[model samples]
Target: MNIIEDLRARDLINQMTDDEGLENHLNESRVTLYCGFDPTADSLHIGHLLPILMLKRFQEAGHRPIALVGGGTGLIGDPSGRNEERQLNEENVVQEWVKNIEDQLSRFIDFTDDQKGAKVVNNYDWLSKMSIIDLLRDVGKHFSVNYMLAKDSVESRIENGISYTEFTYMLLQSLDFLRLNQEEDVSLQIGGSDQWGNITAGLELIRRTSQEGEEVKAYGLTVPLITKADGSKFGKTAGGAIWLDEKKTSPYEFYQFWVNADDRDVVKFLKSFTFLPLEEIDELAKEVEERPEQRVAQRRLAEEMTKMVHGEEALNQAQRITHALFNGDIKELTKEEVEVGFKDVPTFELEESEKGLIDLLVEANISSSKRQAREDISNGAIYINDERQQDLKYFIDENDRIDDAFTIIRRGKKKYFLIKHV
Candidate 1:
């Protein structure tokens, strides 16, 4: 199947400017398309995953994909999906974020000088050089006040009162499209559902600026905004957004995010996220229907995502940490693995080289008091490194430490506490 067909199968296509025309354009030649990412934060999160993957999909299908980092428009945030004006960041901070996001985008898109190799461009290059007169006379003239006001992005924020800076964000984005179309021969722009207005505005600018009788091939497409089966926001948890950077969210935590996908959402997530064949996904969908308790689909989803975002070794490490935790074999994990596996668990730092088991338990508050500590030990409820230690006189020492750094103390069946050897 064609790339568009595959996207349709995954329900990735939320809105397309011209369905038939875009498909014909894709089939006719090696189409160059782009998706813009405004660096609002230090790292791109899971919320940005779909569009990045969309670019990769086009690249694999022998099309050039340009990953545009909005170093310029980022200064004046796009008010597309926001309810209020975004606080502008300092130029230096935005530049740092742009570099970080650029490095992250490089990991997904192949930049080697191949036939369909991808390119990363920063709009700041040209936008910064253009004077205000040039912007108003050349670009801004194409967009009328009524046309801009009719946009959902501007209209939505009309009552809240958008600033002139933000109100003109659409014009800036349109200028990006026109510039890329002229310089790089870009014919398509893609983004999330919220960006439909900006994408089409760019198309309008391209149409207005083209020579009379010129047939503009520029088109816009957007992917659906992901939703959860439970109606909670996607890409968020109690901890916060699931970041693409491993330092922000460890591979173990990232893996667990997909592994914990709801049964109702797992199949849809598999379709949207994974490059797994539809036939294979269909089989996984059947497993979701027949033996969901096994969680076969969820595990596969986690595997695909973890491997894609993090490398194979990171995926293995996450899986190893997960396995060690699930099998109650904490002793098998390394100090780093233990850190990632039990990162959210209660922790206590030991100042001394050794401490009596009862005192340690009470000191760490794993047990309410000394009496409860002894009672828990005597009742065979206390375990050190997954080994039941009923000895009331037992002392936690270097031997109990994993890599001489961490000691996993299980108070009961599942409540675990990490004792750190300082």
Candidate 2:
């Protein structure tokens, strides 16, 4: 199947300009397509995944993909989804983010030098070199005040207020397209649905710059905003954005995010996030319907996404922790794994002298008082490192610490407390 049809089957296309024209462009010759990523933060989050995966989809279909890192335009943030002016990052900060995002993007596309292989390009290469006069005289001529004001990005923000730096973002993005079109023979641009205006502006610039009557070979496409069934935004939790960086969010935590997908949303996520075949996805949908309790589809989606983002080794560790948690078998995990696995759990420092179990419970606030602590132990509801500890006088020792790092204390069935050693 062609790229458009494959994306169509997955319900990924939110909007496209001239569907037939783009399809013809793809069939007639090899097309180079690009998706811009502005390094607004140190790591790209789950919101960035759709475009990243789309680039890979085209590359796999034998087309050249350009992963455009917005080192230049990132200085002026895109106002596509924001309601107010963005706080611009320092050049050095954006530069550092550029490097980090570039590294993460490299893992997704084939960068091997070849016709269909992907290449990472920075807009700063051209955007940074142009002087203020160069920008005003060259790019500023193509766009009129009326044309700029008509775009949704600018129109919506005109009431609240917008900086000229942000107002000029579309023109800068359009210039990136023009430059890439001239240099790489690039013909397509893709982004989230919100980028439709900027993408079209690029196409218009390419058309006008090509001679008086020549056709603009380029086109644009966008994927829908991933939504949640519960009317909440996807990729958000009590913590924050599900960052792609392992340092910001551990592989264990990342895997758990997908593993806990809402039953109503799991099927849609499978289609958008995974490269699994349509038939396989349909089958997984059936599994979701047949045995919702088993959460078969959630497991498959988590496994696929975690493997793609974090690789096999990290995925294995995540699964081991997950299994150990469910089966009360956490003793097998190493100290480092324990730290990553329970990074957010309630924790207390274990004093060397104050190691008695009853005193520990009261100090850690796991029990209301000494009375409750004794009752909990007698009722066989307390566990440490997955082992029952009924003896109220049981003194915590180094042996209880996993690899001499930390100890897990369970109060009742689900409440867990982490005691860290000095």
Candidate 3:
């Protein structure tokens, strides 16, 4: 199938100016395309995966893709998805974020010296150099107040409010497209569905600004807003955004996020995130219907995405921890792996003198009272390191610790706590 057909099958295409024309153009030539990523944070989250994957998809299809880092535009944040104006980051912070974001992008798109190799361009190169006269005389003339106000990005914020800096963000993005098309011969732009207004605005600027009878053949496409079948936003957890950086969010946590996907959303996520062939995904989908209790589809999706984002070793570590936790053998986790796996679990620090299990429970607030603690031990409802501690007199010494650092406690079947020896 053609690229458009492939994207259609994966449910990646949401809003396109003209898929037929773009498809024909792609069929006839190796068109140059670009997707802009704003470094609002130090790292891209899991939600940023779709468009990066979209760029990767095109690069694999022999198109030269440019990953535009919005070093300039990020200074004034995009008002597309925000209810309020974004507080601008210090230049130094945004510069650091730009480096981090570019490193993340390198993992997905090929940047080798091949003819169709991906390229990274920062809009700050041009946007910072342009004067207000250049901006008004060239770009501002093409955009009228009524037209800009009608766009969803501006219209949604009219009542709540929007600042002049953010209100003019679309023009800045349009400038990026125009600059890239002129300099890099980039003729197409891709982004998330929230970026539809800006993407089309870029297309308009490209058309109107063509110089000396030059014909402009630019296009825009935006991927769907990924929503879970459970009617919640994708890539978010109780802890917050699932970051691509291992330090911000561990590889194990990232893997577990996909592993725990609902059966309903697993197949859809596989199609959107993985480059797996449609046939293989279809087979996995069939397994979801036949033997869902095994969670075959969810396992496959988790493994594929984890490997894609983190690497094979990280995926293996995640699977090992998952199986160990399932079999009640969490003692198998290493010190660092344990830290990554249970970072969010409730934890209590144990003083050297306070090693007795009953007192520790009372102090850690794991038990309401000493009476409750004794009764819990007697009923075999208290566990030390996944081993039931029936002795009310049991004392947890350094010998009871895993790696001399941590000891897991289970109050019951589901509730878990960690004891850290200071």
Candidate 4:
């Protein structure tokens, strides 16, 4: 199927300016498409994956994809979906973030192919060179106050009062489209649903600045806002956003995020976030229906996402940690794996080299008191490093420490605690 057809199947086409025309344009030749990512933070999160993957889809379909890092617009902030004005970041900070986002984008798109290789551009290059007088007389003159005010982005912020800096963001984005169209032969702009106003404004600028009889080829498309079946926000957990950077959010946590997808949302996530064939996804959906207990679809989603973002080794590490935890086999994991697997588990530090197991339990708060600690030991309810130690006189010696650094303690079948040997 064609790129548009595939996107349509995934329900990714939220809004397209001219459906038929854009489809024809894509089919006629190798069209160049651009998607702008404003670096608001040092790392791109899972929320940015849809558009990034869309660019990949186009590139794989024999088209050029330009990943635009808004080094300039990021400084001003796009007031697309915000109620309050964003704090303007320092130029140097924004530049650093721009570099980080560009590096992240490079991991997904193939830039080696000479003919249809992807490109990464920063709008700061051109926007930084243009003077204020040049911006007003040349680009600003084409947009009327009424046209700007009519936009949903500006209109929604009217009551809250938007600053002139933010109110002019649309013009800056439009200039990007016009500049890219004229220079790079870019014909399409894509973004999330919230960016519809900015994308359409860019198209308008391209058409207005063209020669009197010129036919503008620019078009705009946006992906739908992702929503969970349970009505909670996507790409968010109690800990925070699911960051693409492994340092920010470990591969294990990222894998867990997808592996725990709701039964209702798993199929939809497979369609939107994964490159799995439609036929394969359909089969997974059937698996979800027939054997909900197995969670086959969720596991596949987690594997695909974790491997794509972190790499095969990281995926394997995450799976290994998962398996070890599920089977209560703490001794099989390495020190690094223990840190990732039991990061949220309660922890206690041992100042001395050894201590009696009963006293250790009471001091670590594993048991309420010395009496309870003895009772827990006698009842075979206490385990050290997954081995049941019922001996009331047992001591936590060097042999009990895994890798001579940590000791895993369990109260029952599931509750786990970590003891650090310092």
Model 4, poorest ten-residue lDDT window? Answer: 110-119
TM-score of each: 0.97, 0.97, 0.97, 0.96
lDDT of 3 by residue, 1-422 (tens): 98999999999999888878888989999989999999899999999999999999998888989999999999999999889999899988998999999999998988977655678988888888999999999999999999899999999999998999999999999989988888888989999999999999999898887886986689999999999988878999988889999999888889888978988988889899999999999999999899989988888888988898889998998888788778878877888777887888899988684478898889988899999999999999998878899998898887678887889898989788988888
Counting clashing residue pairs in each candidate, in order, gives: 0, 0, 0, 0
**Please, what are the lDDT tens digits per residue for candidate 1 over residues 81-195?**
8899999999999999999999999888888776456789999999999999999999888888999999999999999799999999998999999999999999999999999
Who is ahead in lDDT, 3 or 4? 4
Write candidate 2's Cα lDDT for 258-363 as tens digits: 9899889998999999999989988989988999899999999999999999999999999999998999888888888999988888999976843989988999
Q: Tell me which of candidates 1 and 3 scores higher on lDDT.
A: 1
Q: Which residue pairs of candidate 2 clash?
A: none
Ranking by lDDT: 1, 4, 2, 3
RMSD of 1: 1.3
Which whole-number lDDT from 0 to 100 does residue 314 have in model 4? 99
C-alpha lDDT of candidate 3 relative to the true structure = 0.90
lDDT of each: 0.94, 0.91, 0.90, 0.93
